[model samples]
Target chain A: DAGITQSPRYKITETGRQVTLMCHQTWSHSYMFWYRQDLGHGLRLIYYSAAADITDKGEVPDGYVVSRSKTENFPLTLESATRSQTSVYFCASSKGVPETGTRGYEQYFGPGTRLTVT
Target chain B: AQSVSQHNHHVILSEAASLELGCNYSYGGTVNLFWYVQYPGQHLQLLLKYFSGDPLVKGIKGFEAEFIKSKFSFNLRKPSVQWSDTAEYFCAVNPYGGSQGNLIFGKGTKLSVKP
Candidate 1:
């Protein structure tokens, strides 16, 4: 497809193991985000990158790491994964926030990766 | 910190029945509202959004939402829903003037329509 994509649609990992989720977008969007969806928490932002080299923490960032070395790729790594980290992960991309006199832009989401920590 | 609340966790309705999903946010500043839908085994897609101006915004698939600034609510509605409308709906908000384009999402409402 021409939109965003995530690798390893489904994954199973053991506790204390390191797992990485990859996200790629062909649109050259300036902003990329990582979110985890749980039963009660619809989708919580874990991290977000404004550009290739600028990244920041989101609502829940502990035990999670993200890097945006290139505009088309944003990878999220969970170091020492725990059972509580098992959830569906979604990646989204946007063309950056609108400036003072511009309209807002919609975000495009990837097909989500289902991660299970055993 | 900002948060979104979805009034209904699960809703069941027959075909052609009216539909309404309530959403509220806790942000005090200017914000942009959005409604997203996820079908079975599909990614989330934007249904509607309200940034400014008109409070009532129309989205794809015959969906619409009204943004009430005073109540801090954006409710999704449809006069008559089809079985195809059965899916999970989520409400999200993006605070205006925020550095990044991050969004705070509601806990989603699962709608099941009987054919």
Candidate 2:
């Protein structure tokens, strides 16, 4: 309730279909990240947002799109899903304190979204 | 690009047995290291972190990690592990200056402690 949460904990969609995974954080953290967990790959970042309307690409951002229209919501969209994209997706949030001159903030993760693309 | 490497992909130990999980990162400069645990059917939670000061960092449930800068390693250890300690453990690194707080995670090690 107070921490980060993801909608549609489990999802199944056909190939070439559009799907969105929603992430919401009540903490109002300035930073939000979307990562995909797959066998042998661990958790690879797909996209991250510094603040509302400020998003950046991560390690594996190809097939995935993310938008943070509001500080509380950062949704990841799959333009046209593929079987390779079937994996557990995780959303993480961290509060940045620029005064520290270093990015030492701890990140909190939400219950992952298990997406199955067929 | 920064990356993390977890040596052990899967580990098995009996109850009360000692536990150790090796983690190494490929980053030249300052970094913030972290250990996260994901219990069965649960979200990933921070087990411990190393920002500065003492290299020996203690975490929840008798878990501890020692950051060895020279070796570019941060290995997690526990004196006595229990059956409840069976879970997936991940080691991550966030490079200090240019990373923008994005973490580079390892492949993770799954620990199974027999009761």
lDDT of 2 by residue, A10-116 (tens): 99999999999999999999999999999899999999999999999988999999898899999999999999999999999999722246548888999999999
- Consecutive 10-residue window with the lowest summed lDDT within model 2 chain B: B94-103
Residue-level lDDT of model 1, residues A1-118, one tens digit each, is 5799999899999999999999999999999999999998899999999999999998889999999999999999999999999999999999977545677877999999999999
TM-score of chain A of 1: 0.97
What ranges in model 1 sit over 4 Å off? A98-100
In candidate 2, residue A96 scores what lDDT? 73
Model 2 TM-score (2 dp): 0.97
- Which 10-residue window of candidate 1 chain A scores lowest in summed lDDT? A96-105
Error of 1 at A22 (Å): 0.6
